[model samples]
Target: MTMHNMKLKLTKVVAIVLLIVSHSVTANTGQPNILWLVIEDMSPLLPMYGDSTISTPNISQLANEGVVYNNAFSTSGVCAPSRAALATGLYPNSFGANNMRTSSNTAETGLPKYEAVPPVNTKMLSQLMREAGYYTTNNYKTDYQFKAPKTAWDENGIFAHWRNKPSNKPFFSIFNFTTTHESGLFEPYGIRKLEQRHYFSSDEKKIALLPNDHRIKTNEETTPVHIDKATRFPVPPYLPDTPTVQNDLWKVYNNLAETDKQIGAIVSALKNDGLLENTIIVFYSDHGGPMPRQKRLIYDSGLKVPLIIRFPKGYKAGTIDERLVSFVDFAPTTLAMAGISIPEYMHGHSFLDTSNERQYIYAAADRFDGFTDTIRAIRDNCYKYIRNYRPNEPYYLPVAYREKIPSMRELLRLQKDDALNKAQGQWFRKEKDDHELFNVCNDPHELSNLAYIENYKTKREEMGDALELWLADIKDDPLMKERQLIDKLWNGKTSQPTTEAPKIAVQNGKVTITSETKGAFISYRMKNDETSPHWQIYQKELPIKQGILEAIAHRPGYIESAPISLAIDAD
Candidate 1:
């Protein structure tokens, strides 16, 4: 027999043994691999969602073989806070992660870097999967409004892929495409920041996605614009239907086509690895569109995202799920898919496991970059209620990052000249109503304010009451000063708290781990296991296994310590 054949058989045997250890592991099929295809700053603009502007063939293919979720909503209108909720299965507002971003290179906010301080023993979704022996990875976009725990993923970088893991181990991997990001609408048009936003230490990934590289078979930059400029695009009521606006819409569709090509490449990779039928593929966006009244506001245009989940062996294929799924539900749902127990601390319930359904999805908007505005929204299937705490503040805040877009510049110019009509001038209002209500089913654009409408008084009051009850339950204080919140998170200090390295003790034929830092989660990995490169959260005293053990300690907002290794003698 060939050496390669012998090695493959041994690897499969080990993988089967590992799966047997986890109680919730799939019986005959082995554990299903989970893959997340995340795109930035996009909304439901595909054929699956009733738009024919441009066809996303790859996304369409996934939809045909998967379930389409029409009512999926994000916790926030933007990425960072929404990501925080996604990572922890909790509301971003519940943990002080409601802001768009925790820290920025611009330093316009004049506040030090901070991390969303969740309650004790809170672990990220990926970290939870690692505990269940799944090889976890992220192709590097983690704008969670906090630094990810060191134990989050086995590999997290531009090159991280499922192929790099042990042949037999089931994996949970994430790949983020920035082709359709808000930055795509920037002055330079398709290449300025180029996928690396939040400007983390990703200099090594600077050359990851090359512009117009033909070597990659599905290189998005090399493709022609799928939708022509002459094509009449659907214009939202709030934005003017001018040449500049039409051009921006053209770019958005073209960018999505490029994003589809990238998605196709990833699907091809999974097929090449022979894991397509054994993995569950999820395609979704970070938030809604990047246009005005879409990216930063709490309207449905900003909060709703497109979601398609393709299950292994075509489970629930070609089905449309109208359940009100939220970003907070993502973590729990993924964990439940892996047969892991969802923690009670999680604010979201397992959509796949539980029979009960969510009646409403809540979204919030706090400070954005340097601008501070307080807005909260609650949406059911048909109605949406928005409460603006600062009624005197303009509906529009001149966010520096957004002003970089050409169409935004045109809108501002038109507003200054008073050339904008009533619909186009909605965002430029001097002040907004304290409370607003909209029947989103009838007015998807959320332009018709029904807060004072006598006919819809009952619906408006019910939504308002729901919003108030949600805020109190989550203990969300949008009125809190950013500086004060920062101080509270850091234990009255202006700087972030550091987590002390974990101390390990070997006793009674078992290993125990502890950390001095408050709220620091301790996890470890066996150095001798080639398939288990990721750290597993320490649940209880683990019996000494046949290998050397290595462990690392980390907390969000603090630097992780070097791994501490300990040699173990076989019993």
Candidate 2:
């Protein structure tokens, strides 16, 4: 056989092994079963991507045994919008998910006035998958638009039954693992920086896993003492290589290893349960690894993610597809895998079609809440264009972000002192970068701004126009009814500079403040701050339905709110 044929055969061989492992049939007979093993805060440091020291054996093994995607990207940097875009397969420009906080119980306050509620007038992947005949379930750790596709899942991940896995048709089970979530434990940073702990050995790792040892330090003036800081990590190119930063990155590496172990358990469970076959598994994180500027910002570090798919025997494997695919394309792609027709409302096209042109990928970030900044970007094969809606805001705000890592505070101090070098200082000094562009091929770190570059002007404008056209066609004006309230409740602070208006909220549930102009105003049309203009706004009494309210308040404004189920009766 020719070399090309040999390569194809080898790929198919790998696919066959997984098929055998999952007990799946080769053909597309009964629609491919969907299984998404999503890991939290992980980057593509897998062995397949050439990272040898990462302790991700199970994941690494999967990479070697399946297909790897080097160009898969998420829609937003933060968890909620990223997962929201993935679920809806629409850009944040279309789906308005400002940021979701761990304790976002402002039901009485309102939604973001400028942000769109997710599952925004579109069919979800799971909903489409169900019509195509698949049982969908989520295990744990969901960071998407909270109530999008309200009834998409047949079961929650923390509660799915494999035995009920429906022998007749296929199954789409999603397990979003959060073992690598940023727990306030990495190394500290600051004037008196800490040193990296060389703990490669298993025993050393155990001993080094102490809270004080990994303290991430900040300034005595601005930093708090009560903050936890043990998982110090290595500072990125933008920051100085202080001891605390080194320790912080080291902890992140350890977290990656720990997350890998958890994934192995889930895979082993699938194998042990005799449901390995007949399932097509796709492994990816919602976005990049959980690092500063990596999680909630709009750079490639935050948007780009690693995707690996393992299919059982009848197809190909051990292949590499380097097409520029975004989370927007995920829904249709998934529906295609489930043998369903793509919906017209979705702006995304399926990447499953090998002939699909992967010319560009689009991503955007917004001041999702009162916590973050507003930014949007578009990327083609070689260039990326960014438009910061709020240029006066600081890159890092007083979200739970500052509360999570200790070193972060120290870095901020250096930023003020101008001690950070050129690269690291850019984010600090960038108090007014309204429009920027970067030649991604030359500047993968996205440190340089090509927006002002004379030669790339045409290219930048073209991409910008494309982004605008896409948004316009989708009726994504960033203001509908519920979306407007969410924006005010979230981004009301910064957007004020442009709108020059006073933002009002619904307090004590009585006043309906109408503005003389179009700005942030609250109108309690619905009792529950409902979005529908037609719905009546009447607060009769608290419902009898209730759940065990475990007053688990968060540090505020970082993560998506944890869903609280109203119990039938009060405790």
Candidate 3:
């Protein structure tokens, strides 16, 4: 061959080598998309958690291919406070969000309606993901004890999905399944027709029909039941072993089956888009079980939840992680998974970092509806310590909302007739002990209180001292009056404060926006109205364009500022 021909062949080989190297670099450095499947009012009751009474094939498959967390817990036993901790990476007690239903029933409590206010620099988890160039979405639930700022999500309704995001950007999407919620146990039980989406394919017709169907109520006779009524379920000692309690237990399992199907449908969509291999899938409940004592109590049945995480390429497949994880750790974990920096102000350290393993987890319980009580708990691998600030208050509070469940009514009936056994009557006691400690490893139901027992005195005192140190670290005043807490959150104001309008400046054919309100972030759209699609988070100056530029400012716990528009002329 000629010398010139040999030189051309070597040049072609070098070009091909460089091309392969460039592709590998891009694939390794790109962010992985995240999907969160958050279910409501559920515990670690599935077959994956050793409860084989009900089969959840979809969830079991996830566990087989991912890591199963044996010790995941929520910050609170209830939803609002737990969700607040998940969103902020801070404890609810640290921000005055420990109480349930802070934004409603003002007349019943004789206190003004208020929202929990976190530190000024804190941002919602989704908002932080957005600032890091991710398209964030939430499917319809934002009960974080404060109204979510407009800058939090790109799409935040029933129709929100990762499909609506730009093709080039990575996505962080959440889908909340309410099928297993506590309200589902109400009388005249029937599943909502909206859940029918789980049974059908994700075609255009199914998507279009969901929004127009206002008849959420359906016939109980026609609804599908996964568990038979005759199936005998293991009843807790605190609850009566009657048919009424068994039937409620049946409903719980059936609801979980339905939710599993819904989760399968969403996962199918991700696979169909060919993004499954590049995404991180997380499945967990907002809190725990929804029965009478389980919903609001700070026991293991209420605070412990099941967590499964499937990483890309099946990393750590079929492994079980026994580290103590809390709801406060969720925000930092997600940020870490996406290769973003975790904020220094966040109270939680990422579980992905093996060096940051926790020695203990904590939880709290406060007001439920109009009634109020103060309880705090701390747990290690084996023991749990709970302290009751209101020792004079009865253990049982008459919450009207919880009464809708048939099991709750059954408990009430047994108590009135004096037919409850000693074990079952523990919850109906007239008053509570000042301190309670339990060896959770042995008494899973927390049946025996070991605070006064001399055998466990050393362990009890050790846990008590740790709890006090935690309270001091967080600066939480759990004994403060509700009215006084509200005053502090609002800065002694009678009404909520509004964010100041954003100011826009134009110079050198570039535009910048700012707000006078401290910690307020701006959102803008170069289009028609506030209802327009995709209000972009203002992170940097943009080149001036010819259109109506609408913008608004917002800070969490404050009313959004009035929108302002700017008109730009053509050159």
Minimum summed lDDT over a 10-residue window in model 1 is located at 198-207
Model 2 C-alpha lDDT per residue in residues 1-571, reported as the tens digit of each score: 7999757744544443333434464233456667898876666766777665444788876776677888888877767777767777666556445444422534532432233444323555776665555766666445565443223555554445333555675678777655455552443432222121212232221112112233344554543333234544334587678876665666566556655765676666666555566667789987776666567777888888889987765345788888888888877777666656666667677666565667777776655344645666788877888877678876665555444575676677787787888887676664857788988888978998978878988988898898777668755553244446445335555331221122222334322223222322111222233233221111132233232211111111212223222213333
Between prediction 1 and prediction 3, the one with superior TM-score is 3
Model 1 lDDT per residue over 384-443, tens place: 999999999998988878988888999999999999998889999999999999989999
- lDDT tens readout by residue for model 3, 151-261: 899989767878787778888998888888898788767644333233335563222114313224545456667787789997888899999999899989988998898
Choose 1 or 2, whichever is better by lDDT: 1
Better of 2 and 3 by TM-score: 3
Candidate 3 residue spans exceeding 4 A from truth: 1-29, 191-202, 205-221, 529-532
Which lDDT value does model 3 have at 394? 94
Candidate 3 lDDT: 0.84
Lowest lDDT 10-mer window, candidate 2? 549-558
What's the CA error at residue 426 for candidate 1, in Å? Answer: 0.9
Candidate 1: where are CA atoms >4 Å away?
1-29, 105-107, 196-223, 506-511, 523-551, 557-571
The local distance difference test score of each candidate is 0.81, 0.58, 0.84
Task: Give the lDDT ranking, best first.
Answer: 3, 1, 2
Q: What TM-score against the true fold does each predicted structure earn? A: 0.87, 0.69, 0.92
Sorted on TM-score, best first, the list reads 3, 1, 2
